[model samples]
Target chain A: MSLYIKYPKYLTAGESCVVVEFADEIDRGANDAVMNLKKYLLTQKDISIVECLPTYRSLAVYFDPTVVSADEVINAAKSAPELDGEECASSFTEISIPVCYGGEYGPDIANVAEHAGISEEDVIKRHSSKSCHCYMIGFMPGFAYLGGMDESIATPRLTNPRTVINGGSVGIAGKQTGIYPIDSPGGWQLIGRTPLRLFTPEASRPTLIEAGYEVRFVPVAEEEYKKIEAEVAAGTYKPLITEAK
Target chain B: MELIIRKAGMLTSVQDLGRWGYQSSGVPVAGAMDLPALRIGNVMLGNPEGAAALEVTLLGPEIEVKGTGAAVFAGADLGFSVNGKAVGSWRSVVLKDGDVITFKGPRGKGCRGNLCFAGGVYIPPVMNSCSTYIRAKIGGVEGRALKIGDVIKIGEPAALWKKLEGFCLPEDLDPAQDANAPLAIITGLQEDAFTEEGKKLLFESEYTITAESDRMGCRLEGAKIEHTEKGADIVSDAIPLGAVQIPGHGMPIIMLADRQTTGGYTKIGVLTPLSMEALVQKMPGSKVRFRRADVSEGVAEQMRIKEAVRRAKELRLSHVSRTHSEAPKPLFGHFILTVEGKRYEITCEEI
Candidate 1:
């Protein structure tokens, strides 16, 4: 399969890492390029390379400068085969996250509805209906930075960030929406919370959602949330994962 | 052998080189703030450079050596003592079972100190690292700082080389006496985001280290750096160690060993490895200035220091003879030594 994608501009992150910029804006194409390059680089298994961190519009390649130079990494990355549309489209895991909205679970649901000029039910429907792309995982471990939030539900972050937001709290800030993997200080407007474990150090794969995966929130009742939370606590609940439709 | 903590002072924790290869998974690479000192202390005891050592911050822990072993203290002179007798820094000292080791508050310019045992601390490795990432509660003892009544096991002692016991790092290798040393910086990922004036201000002005500084980053109180466009926010990208990020409020935060994997603030530059080492040694109110250095220059400086460390290690080894009781036994076919991050194997017969 032949595909033509523009080479990204390489910038130095430090002596040991380089940031490859595909575009200036946070576009889907840029994200795809970043993930594709990261996958391609991993297959090479270069000893000099340390880790590749994929973000919205760029990929940061960390390496040992003592073993390899930035120019060498850039040259290798430039020569990597461009991924075909079908190849890029393949291998996306769709994860269904169970979220309980409104009431104590989401304190800012009414406020979000007011800001978006919609009913509380409409806010939940708009949030859970569309599938969002996991653009990157950062800020905290297993915390997935998602993209593709509906413009109608866009709300501003709290002026004063809360000292602690509970783990699994689903929140939206500006054009982005994500789940908190661990309790942390945050400014995002809370709309809902997931019962599933987004991050656990004990698990073989600590983060449930990886970059480039599709995340869809399924609204559940408060009682169901508690049931699922219990199942998770008992190590019996398996997260629902299916091929992206 | 084991050591029990009698008095856990300030923030004492077990640290090695760092937890690496897990940053992509958002795990902070937590380790000793002063890595050079950690390595020096470990090497002095004939332990691998990456061996887990006790990282004593500001104040120091009072420890009771449960079994006989040799120990070395490196970095800040925290007024180390054994049984009320004063001991010197940067040298290996033989210890007997039931010996009590204690330290006074830092009497020197540096803030952090490292105590390394001959065989290294035998903490279980998490994600392939013995280093403690306290925020995540992973690695080291219960993933937190040492508390009173905690007992840590130490590995088997290296062969006893009496002649090498008193060797110390030369005074020149220690951090410079000036507290306001200029830290070398390489222009970073978001350098273009800052205005020309901002870049000028960074190198021209002096910044005082804030008390909020920790292993995560050094929050500096300095002149506000002007941003040309989005004012300090970014699309959230990987944060390299030593990154000097300017937040919306414009104060620079130099990301360190315990920094989060990625951040949204715009970074103007990153401190050189040596500069990072020097920056960690400074106290809260210490002043700092940034000096521009190219990547090659920074790498070269690191290599130079590594070479110096190699020479220092050789100097200690030269004092050791085959007849020394501490020398590796003939039953052990090989003696493994870590040099400049590479391991070299020497046959016992060859020595």
Candidate 2:
């Protein structure tokens, strides 16, 4: 099931950006045609877009060459219209995510269960069984790159990379996973954490996992991770959402 | 509050001309890494080219003021001074209220500059940006770097404040201030994961800039380039803003302005918002080099720096012979004044 191309290539990311790729393979059908050309260039309000991003199979954009250029964002992304990467995959929104796995919040869960010869409870039951796909949020703010893990609990990533790593911890690396929405300096492999507050930046919508959502995780334990870290610092924990297969 | 820091040199912050629609949430557009010397030092002080100034770095911040405002200082040539009197770099000075100012460090090259103030530098902006992204602390001040006494508040100058002082930057609208020019870029990300001799050893050699460069990237060294056999990682993207990348111990960072909004190596080229505002004013053992441009020469060097800052604010608003328009000869008033009570109305003219 991999058709969807609909013109993508365009490169130049320089004098004001462009990139747009769409597929050189990072799967999920080039990130669902990079989230359907980033929701069709965020509905091209007559093209003046100053940001876009959408990674996992390109998107970048970022315009305003004094108004609009980069050949008008490659002629409005080559006359748009490619759509159907799963027809807005049910206008995305799954959420869930709790995770509290392995001792001391995953110290690389016995090296990812001895590199998958499985045991740490079958590596947390094949990493909280399914449901993942985020495909990019970025390295620092509200992190989240996710994307369906479970390649037999794929691991490998810590060849020495840890000067910090804390905020909502969870990890994985190869075949992707993610979560560390804030402490930083990672290298992945570990796995477990999420007391919520996935980056608040003074609240009112700071970021909790957005890039076509769907997360899922849910495991919780250490006294329900200290009662969902005190109902996420007294704001009454929420993270549950739904709507999407 | 009208500026105060008193001596926070070597890393002053509070920038502007950046922080745009949060890179898909990873933030980090930080701002003012010599963005055309903070938009021509807020277009030589008459403010508004993206206000909130003060970048500095490469040792330079002393400031003191506290009342009388106006300042300008653009990219590099730090020597600056006032209560000690030297006042260099593209005109506009005025300061004076306890004056002070300072900044004498590297007087032979460059390395970030700007200052602009006249009214800007106020603060409180965060998401909509007053710049400063000191590794995600957030916008300016509270987000760190400008310590010493901190004060800083400014904002309220342009009442044509003496035609916003002197205004200079006119040396053929200054170009290659040469901290070793060349930058250019735009080569195409992961250019086939490199190797045509690593794109002829990155546009034929010459690197250097590495005291571990800062504002999130620039780290370089020299000949490494090579890749292909598919190594230097790639599954990451959107680094743009002078990208460059290369990792895998083959060096060639670049990024700039606090970078990292996504990056997993192998970029190859990007540079050109006027080569990242002239390679963030060079200096770190300086010596760059990497030309291959295109994207219409980085959109004609960013429309020739927004047409040299809209022709230096229209030649500082039509040259007005170094400001002096005197014409005040009116005096009339129709009394009716009452303060401590909410009932008063009057009209007058006295200039």
Candidate 3:
């Protein structure tokens, strides 16, 4: 349960940015290290730091060259203390997302089931049974790249991507599964749709899920989905969140 | 001051330096494609370098002014005119109320142009920027491109506006017009992920800008870049503004202002800011060649461009002072004056 990895490589992204890469592959330990370093850097409040973008196994730090040089940023990143395994273990928030599966909400449910050689009910059960950690948020704003999907349910992305996928649609692609936070063209096999607003510029936080958070899907009936949708539209729906043990 | 969009061209939107300090939350830093152009337009009007301006793409918009103000058109030379009469670009022109400003097909090589008023556009800032990210529906006028009949407000002009009128940067200082200019790139990141042949192909061959190019990215179709064992995919990582990412299909995509915050494609290198400035100006079908430049060289080139912009601004200010010896009487106890290309604050009583 201890997710701790050492980042040994740092490369210059450009004249103004530096990328600290943890590992080449996407693993829990690498993601944990990336998230921990990002948290550490933000706390330092370095005047040179303009923005820091954390991904699966790396963090791209954009800085003002006028304020700090690339060598100085790399040196700061190298000297930063690594998080202990225990600290990484407990720093996660578990949020249950209500998803309406099959029929109209999930057009690709049958496709996913056929690919996985399982029934529609089996697909839903497998998807909701396990919790996943957000590795990073990218592609579109608030779109979390999640880890920890059941291998049996893994399905390849659509050969021809749809022109427009609605926001809050839950999708599965290969070993990865995530939700589209905004309406965009995508190739993921969507198995369900979530009623919660994953991204909204009006909100103070803007994005519902951040990197390193834990996510769980809770299958809801059509009536429940409609009720939650209405509440979300009216700004009264509060998402269920609790600290992960 | 106000202006109504009589004919909204292909795409018109308000932009500034960009929306910064929010990329950590997956927000893209969307801004004008040509940063230098945006700055030059603002500088011509005596406005701040980061002031909001209209980014007119391809065919420019037809606008009718409702209040008197000064305006400057910089970057692309899309046949700009005042009521069908041709107007020179890169110079300040005083507008009269009800004057109709319009533009025809591009007369130059660039794809986008920046039109800035004496006072900046007055749209409320979103995430501390007025730049529009149309894909996400954030910033600018209702987070979308300007349509016909959309009226935009302009901020109050500077006290030195009368003197600053007709100010123009020397013709030699204009942005270079080279459709086939080589873009300087700094190799790093996933450069090793590509095959030696791939790297050679990128530098040796000329790529044509396809019609699929947009604010998000400039997708080029040329000699396919072959990847090594990595095969063009990597653990998703944050993308810099001018990252040259090669997808599985082998075509290189130069990420731009509205690019996603992160991507999984293997990026061979990143273009220098100056190179990106020049690259963005090229329209579809324009040919581009890449040249590897040392990091120090790229940085020095950018510094040189910045200095050029600074010098041009100084020249404009000097022209204003030389042409107008008598400064206007102080208005509202404030005497604003420009000296040595710097704005000075002096009370009317002190003056």
Candidate 4:
């Protein structure tokens, strides 16, 4: 049976901001509360909120300091609807991203495979078979924190961080798996690569995957990876997005 | 109009009144560190407050004019000269093509120059402002610093430029010498999070600006204020300009124009808007003292200062229209400078 835990009472973040916390302690339930609260707050259009940033277990709502007071934010937040259980269970969209496992694209894949006590092929198959939920966006814009990776492929982060991880590089750190949005420094263990551009400033919605979206991986050959990367760079690669069924 | 950089001073960048309305997207509100001086310099050349100007650091720059121009130097009275002849500050001077403008030396605290043109600098607005933010790579030269050989375009002179005279001035064109004036601060939302002793330390004790001060925030070194609830960890929250935030290490960092939109530190107080201009002008190594003030006091102070500035503008408008009816045309070009040990150049044009 699942247990329901409410967060601490909401408090004024600033003169115009309010933080409605679900829990101070970090846990799966706390994370769920934050996600639910964020989804619920997104539906409340009259709140005059400028931005809503959700973290591991809390959400910060930024409003115009001149327009709304802290007291008003508190009242509005309290009046917001409670989260429904069914929506939480089935709101994510599963997406299959093609990845090229091992070799230069994933230098640490052998290490991860050895640590997981499994063959490299088994590791690739297992990683490609699971559907993961997008938990949050952070570190840089458009980078999503995906939950629900296959336990067989779980690995800790590298002792040293890579100076540059190219965009679309698929990496796993501990239990969290994600893709690099831009060329940035990271400590995640790279197990594969993708041709998808997770973030592009020129795109209408820069972030292709939003929080709560589901993700799946499909293995591709190294040469195929190269072709896809070239096509994406040339602006001709069409992403395989499945239509709503 | 055009100007060539003779010498690029240390940390010189193109600025305006500061970029606003996009702070939510994490873009900084970058502009002049000393805003009053920048505004006056623009106003003197008949440019609006938001006109692009040059933010010159302690070290001045050097440049040569390419066309007729008129510009005024304001703030900190940095020693300035044109073609070996010392120039008077807070006044408009016309420059002919081929004339060299240079900063001779640093004269006082927080030196800046607003070389306004008749039509203002015409740099394309990136994210709605010409202000440069070096980090996060947004605004100004593809979100980068001005390097050597960058050619900046000057705006066309205003249509009503002929009606303006020389640079505007206050009836009392004198500096207020009260270096020890108490900074009025309104207790912030996290005021109660600080100990009473911390409040006393903030208001009573003195602090000096560290060399780490920049457009981001002012790092102060002095008495360490105590936080209440000893080990309480607070989540990050939205921070505004003039906020005095105390991080885990206990020193107070006053947020400035380019500060982050959100911070995890505890903000004990926020400076009154009336004091922000004055505070910005305080040079490095300058001592600052804070004084507790209620919200009403802050509001009243803001009202008084706004009224004073409004009256000053009106008087200057009348004086300019009556005296010199023609725009003080300058020979367009850039001004060069050398401050302390750094070297840089800034563009100058006639408004």
- Local distance difference test scores for all models: 0.83, 0.79, 0.85, 0.68
Q: What TM-score would candidate 2 get against the native?
A: 0.36
Tens-digit lDDT track of model 4 for B1-351: 666767777766778866554443334567766665666566656567568866666666686777866666666656667887767456666667788878876777445555555566678876567888775555655655555566556677543344443445663542222456877777765677788898888888999989898878999989998888843245444466678888867788988877875566778877765466667767788899988776556555544544444554565455444433385654544457889888987544345
Top candidate when judged by DockQ against the true structure: 3
lDDT of 3 by residue, A151-242 (tens): 89999999999999999999999988999998989999999999999988766788899888899999999999999999999999999999
Return the lDDT, model 2, position A53. Answer: 83
Tell me the TM-score of each prediction against the true structure.
Answer: 0.89, 0.36, 0.90, 0.72
The total number of steric clashes, by the backbone 3 Å criterion, in model 2 comes to 0
What level of docking quality does candidate 2 show? acceptable
Winner on DockQ between 1 and 4 is 1
Tens-digit per-residue lDDT, B242-304, candidate 1: 898998887899998899988888988788878887888888988899888888876775676
What lDDT does candidate 4 reach at residue A2? 31
Candidate 3 C-alpha error for residue A111, in Å = 4.0
**Candidate 1 DockQ vs. native:** 0.58
The best candidate by TM-score is: 3
Q: Please give, for residues B152-244, the per-residue lDDT of candidate 3 as tens digits.
A: 999987655655666877776676545566998899998988889889999999999999999999999999989998687787888999999
* For every candidate, C-alpha RMSD to the true structure in Å: 4.7, 22.0, 4.0, 9.1
Residues A59-113, candidate 4: write the lDDT tens digits. Answer: 6676654455556666777776776666656555667788998888888898789
Which is better, 1 or 4, measured by TM-score? 1
Ranking by TM-score: 3, 1, 4, 2
Q: Give the alpha carbon lDDT tens digit for every residue of B1-351 in model 2.
A: 388887799788888987888788888787888776667667666678899888888788887887787787787778887887777777787776888888777676676677887778888787788888878788888888897888988888654445455667788776434555687787876778887987888888998888988899889898988888988987888887778888888878888888988888888778877667667777778777888877787777778888888888777655422423386533333346778886675534332
How well does chain A score by TM in each candidate? 0.91, 0.36, 0.92, 0.87
Worst 10 residues of 3 chain A by lDDT: A1-10
